[model samples]
Target: MPTSENTFHLGLTMAGAVSAGCYTSGVIDYLFEVLDLWEKAKRGNVQGIDQNLVPKHNVIIDAMGGTSAGGMTTIISTLYALKGKLKPVKKIPENPMENQNVLYDSWVHLDDNEEKTFKKIWDVDDLDGELTSLFNSKVIDAIATKALDMGGDVNDFESYVSENLPRFISKDLEILLSHTLLRGIPLSVDFKTEIARRLKNSPMHNTFEHYLVSHFKLNSGNPVNENSYLWFNPFKEKYSDKIKLSTISTGAFPIGLAYRKFDNTQFSDEYIKSVTRRVIFGDFGSENPDVNHDIELNNYPENYSSISVDGGAINNEPYREVGSILRSKFHKDENEYQNYGLIMIDPFPDNDDIERKYKEPKNLLKVVPAIIQTLWNQAKVKRKEMLEQYNHDFFKGVIYPIKHRIINGEYKGRDKNPIISASFNAFGGFLDVNFRVHDFFLGRNNARNFVQYFGCIPYDPDNGNVHPIHREWTNEMVEKFKVSRRGDERIFLPIIPDLNLLLEGKEPGDDKYNYTYKGKPKYNPSELFKLKDNIYNRFKKVLDKGFDSFGEKTEEESETPISDALIRREYRRNWFQRMGDNVKSWVVGKFKNPVKKAIASMLSKFVIKSILEDLEQMEVLDDKAN
Candidate 1:
């Protein structure tokens, strides 16, 4: 047996390697959810390029000359510097190519017609006037859609972003100067044509770059012998430089840029919409990550129109009604729940003289489903916790009375009663931890599976140690808490000295493997974690399947699987005491219950007061120049 000191330290080091797997599972769930929605949308042959498959709170609008409720998040972040938003500390380097003083109305564009929307030019390169207009109108989504097709020329993107970007910066460019609404942003770095040719044949770093192969999903699962990590953190030390935190748009779905091409020149934006406006069934993309240009799509919940393979225009009476513009893109397997949706977008009509290409694929819509679920579910779960956590001990210890007196200007004290108390206000609080989709492609997982390490760190009211809102804490915190408390995880980790190295055909105790854990040959530590995850997942599947004995299970099932909360709460209470010792709670003697009237009155006060504050400080958050 290993000594206590060695045993605990050994556990921590070992768990780190396998910790990613658990996080990966969570992230993969989101990835699949996103891919499923996008694939379905693409297969359904959805119209607009801005269709979002994620969950958001914004109203769906007709922007970018079409309809979409999402993508603003990505556009906002990418255009952040365009709006002068300050970057967070220790974040990726900011792109200094464009000005940060402008802001755009995200919901509306300049005009539908290209000529009427004639924009000016301001680029170092001579790509001006009509050419600049073409790029902004053609390349930048600006207001309407948010997907970028970096297909034809990586050089064009490199130059546009590097040199001529100022040309497209509109008058109102500050729309994204604040925290954006979209969740995860996928940055596209296209490798095609000249770009592909140069890199594929390069000799010096070609071998290393080749090793950094692209990972794809859509296959039921992943295969070994490939670079297979899917749940990726752009913030990871190894790939931090390659992953630009500032540039990662919340608009992107998959963490990495997907590759696609428009095969026909006639398949212009207006033509495709007008052409398939009434089509029934269409194929778009498939479940295979490597497969594209194979799927087609048409309106769903409507009759599948007979699409002529020769394909020019629809001749079928122009009266076939597709029932509902159903969210046909959510190609979820039975196991995956409909956590969120991909909005069906509208297409632009041919009132504009823009060259229409029905054959060539102009833009691609990406999906980050697990992130959608993460944000959506967090909103729900965190909202519940916020309500529950407060309600349980709310209006206690006369804090409310003291605060009320101060708000009404009745109380005046420096130390005892601060004039402005942030305790009651939630303006600046740590975001809830529900690591939705931290990374689309995690380590060696083929970028298909979503992954994130979640589950709240142990908090002690006596000790002010707590988790910050909306941030990913270090794995070290979890390990410390787990081992300190002898958690099921810490207790269960097996003894494995060189578990990771063992995979490389090296024997334990040969190099750094010979190290002792208290006294024992550090047993394969990773096996414990693998076992734990396997056991947990198996149990989850069992519960999801409903009953142990098929239909024999009743509504009041004899037994229920233990919840994380239950275990932690019980432990806390047993170790100290619930309702009496560990937690402090007090009941007010003169508590009034005109609860309805007071609640309504309070809400009215909050709204009016908040509006006044907003009006007074419109530029409180304005960005200062560098």
Candidate 2:
């Protein structure tokens, strides 16, 4: 959140890396090279050239480092980057992704050429997400209905389209060149996709609502005594079972990761244990958690979204004929694709072990920390410029206005920044700042709770209970955590609190399992907890009974939902309190930020946008004057 500064550029490049949007070899390589440079930059060296972090000679590298244009305007802007004079790379592509509204829209169009251009690279999937907000809106349907009619004034009707909608649709993720379609009407693809999302949101989307209401077996009240946003995180099926994409639900706006089924029907111990295992090892590949590398994927079979597709299992037969025909012969130990059962539906690339040196593991807890460190390195290396933009103290002016507007809530309306909105809708938006901290900031728990919170799906059919951040399985590793024993990572019970504990810090008894504080001091839930609610639990319960029939899918399980009213009350109280806290923060942060400072800070974006807008307005004024 630090603002960018010109005089002393600390780390602005990080931003570019953090959310560059597109994923390509070029961007990836650039990011990696930048990280290499960053490692050197920490010592102010680029190819043995050590200077100030922002040296006049490093202009091109620094300029290209972020998503900015380098024309006279930004060239003038780069005057800050220069000590005084070095012929700047005066000509820059005028269409920078971060600037320009129409350009952003162009990217969202899909099927444009030059996939890397911000507009071309804009990811359409995110835009599809934005349309989801309108699921409850009757207006979109009316518009769609009218559009289908093909009779009325399309232009006037077009005006009915919310600014947020277009922005969401046209978010160009800034890819370079690829067969991947760029900005164009995806009606052929989109028509059905849009319909599917809406269908998912329907209350009647489930088959067992009657059972849930009638039986009331899995009934749960909001776990309110515990501070949390969602009462339970649901799942779609049992662990090691088929992952049902249909039941998955999107949580929060501008999300990351894929869709999740936030229903929480799967609360059985089995479910919880599986989730824990996956969260820890599954992500890094469940090898010994010792050998750290892509090689860990060696034993890991390629994703088999289906079975029976590829002869019911992996075919080890090499494709030397095809490879030879294509002038690339296959290695005896080359990767292949595997097909798992109905639990998976797609043929996954196959990878078994041929046993390379570092292609193995030696420990377990090292897995979490290893992943954390790796992401941290990558994030810092890639997005240093964006992250440390204010290192030179140039950010005071840039961020003030954003701070003010956020305080003022001016951006509650979507059109304020169409590009940002669309971009978020497509890429599932930015990762939560807390997650960013987890990714980069030196920490141990490694944003574990945040990941659990985000990755967990609610209405899992395997276990008929909703377990948000559920501890599904207790392995030796987990038990090590429980006893606070020294696990492989040189320690256990490393004071890593679960989401519930983080939300409600340990009380005297809770820590000791005594339930009530004995002779020790009592710790209570704080103001933040007051704003916590179990609305997630309520919503998940309804979804579990319906979306996946998770609760009743098994003969051993009974679908019971917790009290809706009770849960709603807890959340309402929590949310209301949170609203108050936010208001307070806004009031304090806004006034403290001066308008000039805000303008100065946001001036890059504001001025960039307003320059042409100002000219247009001036002409209109002149016409009126005439």
lDDT of 2 by residue, 183-253 (tens): 11111112335456567443321111000000000002112111111121111113101111111110111
TM-score of each: 0.18, 0.18
* lDDT, candidate 1, 375-398, per-residue tens: 544432223324533323211000
For each candidate in the order shown, give its overall lDDT on alpha carbons. 0.22, 0.21
Evaluate model 2: give its TM-score. Answer: 0.18
Error of 2 at 213 (Å): 28
Candidate 1 lDDT score at position 1: 19
* Ten residues in sequence with the least summed lDDT for candidate 2: 209-218
Alpha carbon deviation, residue 162, candidate 1 (Å)? 31
